[model samples]
Target: MSDNITSNNPSLEDVIAEAVRSGLALVHTSLPGVVVSYDSSTQLAMVQPIVRFRRRSTSTGSLETYIPPPIPNVPVVWPAAAGGALTLGMVPGDQGQLMWAERSTDEWRKTGAADCDPRDTRRHDYGDAVFVPGGRGADDPLPADAYHATATVLYGATDVLLGDSTATDKVALEPDVQGQLDALAAVFNAWIVVPNDGGGALKAALGVLTAGGWPTITGATKVKAK
Candidate 1:
């Protein structure tokens, strides 16, 4: 029997349930290396293992430098069974911007005292470092130490399992899934990065999704093994 389902019709939960069942078959056939598991309540398919990125830092001058801190190990989770895609939500500090300074000398002549040229100096910003404003909350207008950014890539077999056939169908679904993942990642990032202020953007996004007929996955009962 075919497990394909439409995103607009049979609710997200139903779609995900069917997709998880169908996804196992696809995973078995196409990507044998990846291990697949599911979380019933959250409707999340926990793809086994995690991915990591290398971190490095650079120094521009004595007091100024670029420190690219280590990015944490990320877990890949499918947002929803049907309409959503996998997301590796990473809250990376020091990846966004860099700050630096340079020194310059200026000459001055004294009126009477031995005609001295005072070696005056000034600091300058250079390269991408100039883009980052110094001090806390100085460059980023959001009044937070960190901001949320996301990277999304499509899940090919999952799209096909969701009834995406043509090139256009597959392409069309990519952005939609990517947008949803981005929204969720933003919310997760906000919760971690800006804990002081209430997450207004994340709340608003949830409100919009709730209003738009998106249902929340609540319990393990909803999950089924393929």
Candidate 2:
């Protein structure tokens, strides 16, 4: 009446055949398959402990004993001297430092992207996100003469510059860039003009940010009130 040869229980011959088949299957199978998915047709399921049985001698056979390959050095887009003196540029060890405008006589004036601390004048580093072309790596070489539409010191809008006066024949940055810089000035000047409180700070910062007048800080870096 039933399709199974042993409806109530598996006979001794069926048990022996299954054991032999499982033993043979173990020889040519991955470790995951054996450990993760093991289902027997029998009602009484018996889970076997994984054993370290190697047929051939090898230096590193087990996963725990395996040695991974070393990681390669990642590349970056660094600024270099291009027919001019060093300015607004990132050199060997200049990681968390940048130069931007501050309304001071010696704050910022486009020279060269490779320039560092130009003319004994110190520029304030804004904690906002900045975007300048020409940090391209070996795979991506900078064009003979390239220029970016907007250039603002990042993490914050403390200063703004076009990287180089040669980028375009303009004294200032793009209109939107100029507006953000102005908004930054307004926000900063509010402290000088108005009282340095929550209301004043938010009014200035949000005005610029909401109107797409602020440089973005992508990645894990978070923006906070200065």
Candidate 3:
């Protein structure tokens, strides 16, 4: 008699349960991954899945260990619509989530067609994975100095451009601007511009009375970017 259960077997429910488990294992959804490398030009990344695949071996009744190979050329997700996009600088060792599309994305990726059909009947394929970067461990929290109560904050780089990428006007640093204004005010206060038509001697300069001195123009302490 064969050990494998058939449709006429007494324990039919056991076969059905095992079949469901095997099918569910093949369905790829989402998993945590670490970025191995990123290509900004192509907006693609090489990601190493963080989860280890485990399955019980029938021969020895032991769990088999399998680490998924690094996935390459995975598209990185960015917030975009219409003609505008917000792109981020993804780097190595960045932790993120990997999501597999419902169908094969080969045709869609290659042609950028909205109504394109899958090249094959593959579903929830690992090859169609896209990365969403920004996930971090709870123990490794963001720096306290970078946190803001209400306003949007940008850390690391400070110099900012408000217009197009090629725009020449860059926002000046607050401290630098303040220093320049202070210097100009000092020079103006000292200069004794006496319009002389053969004057005898220079008198005290006409004082430009300010409320106190140069008003302090403080810059945004919370938000900054480059």
* Strongest candidate by TM-score: 3
Clash list (residue pairs), candidate 3: none
lDDT of 2 by residue, 1-226 (tens): 2222333476777667656644553332212101112122211111112233323225442223222121111112134445643233233322321122332223222342444454543233221112222333355553433334575324322222334433432233356566656767766665543465747766766676668835532212222221
Give all candidate RMSDs, comma-separated: 32.9, 27.1, 6.6
At residue 161, give the lDDT of candidate 1: 27
Kindly list the per-residue Cα lDDT of model 3 for residues 87-188, writing each as its tens digit: 655689989899999888999889988799776999887788999987778887778766799878655443333333444444456786878577566756
Q: Assess the local accuracy of residue 11 in candidate 3 as a C-alpha lDDT between 0 and 100.
A: 72
Determine which window of 10 residues in candidate 2 has minimal summed lDDT: 30-39
Q: Give lDDT per model, in order.
A: 0.34, 0.34, 0.73
Flag regions of model 3 displaced more than 4 Å.
1-10, 157-170, 189-193, 197-226
Q: lDDT tens string, model 1, 139-165? A: 535433234456442322222223321
Candidate 3 lowest-lDDT run of ten? 200-209
The lDDT leader among the candidates is: 3
Off by over 4 Å in 1: 1-172, 192-208, 212-226
